[model samples]
Every structure is written in C-alpha cells, then in structure tokens.
Target: MKIAVLVYGSPTASSAAATAYRYARAAIGLGHQITRVFFYGEGVHGASALAAPPQDEVNWGQRWQQLAQEHEIEMIVCIAAALRRGVLNQQEAQRHGKSAANLAAGFELSGLGQLADAALNSDRLITFGG
Candidate 1:
C-alpha cells in the first residue's frame, strides 16, 4: 500500500509528528510503501535546521531525517506554511535575505500540488495532528 502521512505540529513538543513517525516506521516494517511525509502548519518547525536538542533529548529533526534516509521516504514541507513559520530552504532563505536555511536535509520545500498528487496517488492518506 502507498501511504501518505501528513504532520501538522512542532517536532519537539507535538505528539503529532512523533505519532506519524511511529506509524511510518510500523508501516515500513510491515512492508508497506511510504508515498510521502508532508509537513504543514507549525509542523514546519520540524524542518528547522537551527534546532539543536541536548544529548539527553531526542533530536526529532534528526530522527525524521534518519527515518527518511532509512526508508527512502520523501519528506516534503508545504512552502506556504514553511514561509509563514520562517522555515526556509537555502534558495528561499537567500531570496528572503535570511542568514540560514534549515528545513532539514531529507525534506524538500514543496507546494500544495505535491500534497494533492500524493493524495491522489496514495492508497491511504493518514493525517497526524492536534
């Protein structure tokens, strides 16, 4: 099955992202194909490069990056939502005169069309949010 996981919360504080991560892992373990992981709303913070958690804490950003890498998952963040929340890519940051762009390594800044496409192509679209 092709699964699209939608996350719309902060990485550290929000259980939505964490729950989506777990679902993705479980799905992958069950031999399911992940269509994509889409981030929106405050969830754009999940892609922030400036996030640095202490060694005692779990780095949700890094965890998501690793999940994407291991499972070959396509990580996508909504461009509008990201920009609204100050989550910029290198190009967007430069275009907006920002000092740095985080948006995570495995994540791509994308538009709503991507989500629409994923929804159409995916066998299931599961949303994780408050």
Candidate 2:
C-alpha cells in the first residue's frame, strides 16, 4: 500500500506526534510505502531544528529527519501554519528578514496543495491527532 500521513499535534505537548511516527515506521516495516508525511498545526514543530529536548527524551525532529532520509519519504510542513508558529526555512527566513532559520533537515516547507496531492496520490491517507 502507498500511504500518506498527516500529523496535527505537537510532540512536546502530547504523544500524538510520536504515535504518528511509530505508525509510519511500523507500516514501512510491514512493507507499505509511505509516500509522504504532511505536518500541520502544532505538528510542524516536529520539524524544528531549534528544539532542544532533554537527554532522556527523544528528539522528535531528528527522529523524523532520519526516517525520511533512510526511507526516502517526503516530509512536508505546511508553510502557513509553520510561519504562524515561527518555523522558518532558510529561504523563508531570508525573505522575511529573520536572522535565522529553524526548519530541520530532510523536511520541505510547502502549502496545502502538497497535502491535497498526497491525498490524491496515495492509496491511504491517515491522520494522527488534531
């Protein structure tokens, strides 16, 4: 199966984002193809390179980045939601005259069109949290 995933909550605030990660990893382990993962709302925080978790806790952004890199999965963050939450890529930060960018590696900042396309192209679209 070709699957697309939507993550809608913050990993720091709740377990929903972690659950989504586990689901995607398990699905891929079972031989399912994950076409993309679309991060919206607080879920966009999962792609923040600036997040600093404690040594005892999992670094959600790094986990997601590694997964995307190893599996060749498309990881996308909603640009509007990200901007509203202050998660900016290098280009976006430059365009907005910010001194720094915090978007993590292995993730792309895009709009809702990418989510729409993922929904249309994948055999299944699963959403975690909201």
Candidate 3:
C-alpha cells in the first residue's frame, strides 16, 4: 500500500508529527510505500532547521530529516502554512526579503497541489492533526 500522512500540529505541543513518523516507519517496515508526508499548520515547524529541543528530548526536526534520508521519504511542507509562520526556502527568503531560510534538507516547500497529488496517488491518505 502507498500511504500519505498529513500532519497539521506542532512538534512539541502536539504529537501529530511524531505519530506520522511512527506510522510512516511502521508502514515502510511492513513493506508498504510512503508516498508522501505533508506538513501543514504548525507541523511545518518540524522542518525548521533552527528548532532546538532540550538535550533529553527527542529532536523531531532532525528525526524527520534522518527518516527522510534513511528511507527516502518524500517530505513536503505546505508553502502557505510555512510562509505564514516564517518558514522559507532560500529562493523564497530572497524574494520575500527574509533574513534566513530554514526549511532544511529532506523536506520540500510545496503547494496544495502536491498534497492533492499525494492524495490521488496514495492508496490511503491518513491524517494526523489536532
């Protein structure tokens, strides 16, 4: 099966991203394909390179990055949500007069079309959100 998980809450405040991560890892481990992981709302924060967690806490941002790298997951952040929250890509930062871009590696900034596409392509579109 091809699964698309949509995460729409904060990394620390909400466990949506963490739940999505576990679902993705488990699905892949069970011989399923993760078509895409869509980050929306505060879920975009998981892609921020500047996110710092306490030493004892799980660094979800880095964990997502590593999961993408290790499993070749297609991780995408909602551009509208990201832009509203000040998460920008290098090109977007330059165009919008921002000082920094922290969308980070392994995650792409994309529009709703990507989410729609993932929905169409996926065998199941599961959502994790508040």
Please provide, for model 2 over 25-80, each residue's C-alpha lDDT reduced to its tens digit, 9 standing for 90 to 100. 99999999999999999999888998998899889889888898899999999999
Off by over 4 Å in 2: none
lDDT by residue for model 1 (53-97), tens: 888987777888998998888999999999988999999999999
Better of 2 and 3 by lDDT: 2
Note each model's CA RMSD in angstroms.
1.1, 0.7, 1.0
Q: Which candidate has the top score in lDDT?
A: 2
lDDT of 1 at 31: 91
C-alpha TM-score for every candidate: 0.94, 0.97, 0.95
Relative to the unseen true structure, what is the Cα RMSD of model 1?
A: 1.1
Task: Kindly report which residue stretches of model 3 are placed more than 4 angstroms away from their true locations once superposed.
Answer: none
TM-score of candidate 1 versus the correct structure, residues matched by position: 0.94
lDDT by residue (15-44, candidate 3, tens digit) is: 888888888889989999887889999999
